[model samples]
Target: MSKVPDRFLGYAFCVGDVLLELDMDFHIISADGAIKNTLGAVNREQSFLDLLTESGRGLIESSVKMLTGANRLGPFVISVGQEGLAKTEFAVFLAKLPTAEDRIYMVLSKPYRLGKSDSKNAPAQKTEDKKREFFNRLEGLFEGNPDAAENMLVTVLEASAGQQLDDEKRLDIERYLQSFSVGGAHATQIADDKFAVVHDKTTPKKEAADIAAELARATGVTLKGATIDAAEAKLSETDSMRALIFSLQSFASGNEGFAVDQIQKNCSTLIGETTERVRAFREVLDEGRFSLVFQPIVDLKKATTHHFEALTRFELPPIIKTQWEMIRFAEDIGLIDEFDYAVVNLAIAKIRKMLKKGGSPGIAVNLSGRSLSNQGFIFELMSLLRGNKDLKQYLSLEITESAKIHDLDLLSEILDEIRGIGFKVYLDDFGAGAAGFQYLKKLKVDALKIDGAYIKDALTSKEDRAFLRSMVTLCKDLEIVTVGEWVETQEHANLLREMGVDYGQGYFFGKPSPNFLVAPTAAAS
Candidate 1:
């Protein structure tokens, strides 16, 4: 056996969903600089949990052995089935890696597939059949009406290209064919290729391997072996790395093929799973799994607490570990509306709790544009508020300026109704949206929260400072209070104060806390 190169030896594998197959590749670089590759296929029909567990264990052991100098290895690259597949695969890979192998690099690649073509024997008869069908259809159309020969030719041209004929081209082809028919040269004018329909199908599987081999040549990895089962490969010291390379290549190609077939077979199943997850999340909302965290809004002039903005935190499943992941999953599964509604209700509940405890601080909660546009959501919210008069007094709704208010008339009517009910409205992230000024008169908002992007660099950037100053002036003229967010230091706070910003919020005042009522004596005053 030839010794593989030092640079190519590594354990790399692609991960995919249950119904979608996964392919893995192993590249082995022997001590003598010989490159060898191997391929692996993960069966999607089997239990994903069990397969993943086994694969993860193998990965950890291999990585540890490499790191301890028991074996030599290179970087591991993974290609996944879908968008979130990358994150899930990484998480599993991370969990399985030994502590000593923490420095091992991991790379992610875009999804790809192996090419498959029809059998050679099958194509000859199919092509002849299509040719007969085409000529027959053409003859029938022309014989029905001599004057329609032009239209029939245009149809044949479109059919050949596998697309609809444009009006101009159709008319031109019609005229040419009509001229030939009138001159009695139609039969002789037909080209030999025109009688037969040609179909350019994808290349065959073996041909695809050759193409992949060419690609691997550029990467300095050689195709060592191709097998149906990667795990069956002999894991000797010399062959281990080669096996890994072959596995990765097989996985990349096979996964692409599997993704298409799996989507066709189980698209509804996937959709149902997504819907169930969303439904479960909404159920969690109804069960009050959400809690409110408050961040202080400071009155810049008095240097005291103006109000507290309410943010929602959810107790997600172990699968969802990070804040971004949880929010993204919710958004992906179409549960953003439910999530936003839960946040509002949770914030309202916290406000009620605060009021009962004899602390009457103003509470602001964010409302998504989708929620605002939903008549049912607005009715449910209003009903909740009307049922509790005391909670309504302390409630303030903050809406992002970037929200696409599709039905402006309906939105304006809704805003009017919301104001009529005595709930204060704040236009969140002002200056971020194009029509911020235009919305001022249209929206019956009581406050404007300047976007954090503007406030963060206001002092250093003259343009930002000027924009903020102009915004402050515009708000004053309109009698709408302005609040600056992302005030991180005393300098930021001071500048906002000097510019007559009505309120400020960010790290300077306090970070978002689970306990809403905790306040310094000076801020409380």
Candidate 2:
């Protein structure tokens, strides 16, 4: 019998998720407690697929093959049950762990009952699927139209001085873009920090104008004439459609209007704010003027703290009180990577200390959006991880989807390098914007921290519940472990558990604190 690595066992306990390892021959190499408790002991020689429901075998196997290849497909949902027992479905996320031997590693979601006879779940699933379809069509309405010039009106707010928004502010802007639907105006990201709103001719020009005012008020950003009718572009007999689009690109560049003056005012305000932030950021860097407090992520099924998310706090500079303000300002000034590096180092230091004292709970540290595009910082990060190989499994990096990722291919390569060091990466605050799904498709994230809004309103709002169910179902289908943020009560936790949310974080579990360690006596109690 081959011995399983202690590190992998520690990983299973920290994630509160099942771990399964299979060889190239489709035979199980090992199964952790979660698997054993769910599916019973496994024989090493038994084929892994034989355990799955007959209907799901082929799909699961094919998805696994793609997962092992460069063109990896996302997670796959499959049912595992005996003939007499009702089938249970799980979303399974897989990764090829770097090892001397060829093997596939799986992170499995908790089982939820799935069958047509189950009346309780039928309507929710059906409604969510319909909603997803509607949104898909809405997205197409914004993106799929070939002759948008005829029916669509466009407005773009360009980023100045290579500055982009952090996730919170970007989501705020996206929300405002969709909030006013005068004559069914639809909004989509045509480019990074550049959004376009489209409405048919039926929409009154006044309503579109109101939308611009609404946007300006909501975001406090000035918009220049950047508006154009979809049909305004002249077609030439000699020029192709591509040439017409190239010409239209000039129209999108900028415009002349009162909004320009207001934008300059906004920029002036921003400049003053940026200077203050830069001074504060530098002081923190030189003096180590920050603190880290951890908020617990609870496993609903076990009612235990599976991990803690390290949150940063700055002091003495009354101007930068909130973590969001501090982080967002750092992002605006190209100092985010430095801030993220400091947080990661602090988190890793604490995590290492905890592990040495005989505890192995995981810690999730936030990585600022700007760090994704900074190759030098990424190289430094990779080197940092390589030097602390033992801490990899205990450490996870949380990347929020608030800002536009400038270079995804480069980010992907950086993540791959980090993953090669054995650490897990989580897509944090998912379902907040369009980028969530895009990142899911492009990256190899091990888990997802579902956006807090869905969890906060899930119990009271049917719409929120449906949205959550849909998001959880999507994550399950991809096999990504899910954590619900902003869970405030036992009722909320119980509701999320029923909905198949793997983990949760909120005041219901525990509050963020500087002293968040899992003491020996505390665990025993």
Candidate 3:
């Protein structure tokens, strides 16, 4: 026996929404039909039935019965059509259906003549006219009685097929069927007959049908089927082949072609706008349209300077007036990484230059979670440090506590490797979110920078004070130094010092300055 395609067990019943899953273990009947299960299991059987019950299939059946009588096939067809519409409107709904089953029963009957045939360019014109009239009737039927729409649609399908449709003609018919089956605003476009009904829950069935018909008319192909054994056999050959074939057949041809053209139009417009923004950001970076600002860290006991945190400021042109505006534009155009990398490299170089000129205070540079988690970036930082030995001791790598810990083992190993070479690691914004004391022990960092939120409100709030104190004690136990950030006044600094915080950073000492300076003896004292 020939092997089945991997998706052979998956099948579509109704045009847009009636999908069925048939594997050895259990048979699953689904509406809003998209193949979901490649291999059936018993668990999936119960789940499918449960899903149908939840979708109110019973209610749908009752409604169809009221309109189409007890034959059930009529109601079943309408329910299938309704499911088609549901699939387009609700992504969540479609996601629930089994996508890998292929036991589909497509109904194709002889084509029905609506009017007397004309002989003038008759064959081509007749096909167009027939499609237009058929879709128009379908729209009216769907609007008037959605309960009976599926049955009527099936009736239309049965009436529309000529004795035996060639493969190309059958594909066109299938696309047309799918368009109406998956109804939404896009359904109205069925008149165009160029696009395939690639399922987009948001599109109207009429529009989708028009596009599908046109595409089907363009590309001569018909619906094809595969059994479970065939699909599994294909998987053994190549995993990508199935996905590739589906994408090409569904999106690149017939009714799908029209929909893709529309998508391409929208994408092109977005691409153009994004391109302009990217170009503008590149110009700014190229011209060094940014400045480095330093914020002072104070020593409470001596009322002296301890260190400075480097902050980046973009010098916007008159056209780009706001900091947020520039930043948002950069993010939208994929220039965020470029801008951040430039800031990092520039800050490092600036710190090195300042140290060479006898600047004494330690300088802290912020490293985004993205950069820190990147192995290439860590190596780059190491290379920079290697080239500038004199500034190594005075530099600290500040990282956010909430950054995703990508590959924890690798991150710990890298931290140890960097620390081994004399670079200090400070967990910035520590005690934020769910960051626990365990991270302090596990990460083996040199220091923890108390989140600014704790310092800003800890003075007045008992709860905040207790939390900060507990965190400070925890750090102490682990031999990890603690630094209080956003210290705004002498009282805040004094309170932090009393809490055992070894360092502080905020506006109280001095605002960020371009000129780097040593810690004043008074502050250190």
TM-score of each predicted structure versus truth: 0.48, 0.50, 0.48
Clashes of 3: 71
Candidate 3 C-alpha lDDT tens digits along 234-258: 2122212222222222332343332
lDDT of candidate 1 at residue 186, scale 0 to 100: 19
Flag regions of model 2 displaced more than 4 Å. Answer: 1-273, 356-360, 517-525
Off by over 4 Å in 1: 1-273, 319-321, 324-334, 401-403, 433-435, 517-525
The candidate 1 region of ten consecutive residues with least summed lDDT is 194-203
Residue pairs with backbone atoms closer than 3 Å in model 2 (clashes): 75-478, 91-476, 91-479, 92-479, 93-479, 149-230, 149-231, 150-230, 150-231, 167-402
Index of the highest-lDDT prediction: 2
Q: Which candidate is the best by TM-score?
A: 2
Q: What is the lDDT of residue 12 in candidate 2?
A: 53
Error of 2 at 493 (Å): 0.7
Q: Candidate 1 at 474: error in angstroms?
A: 1.0
What lDDT score is found at residue 442 in candidate 2? 79
Per-residue error at 355 for model 2, in Å?
A: 3.9
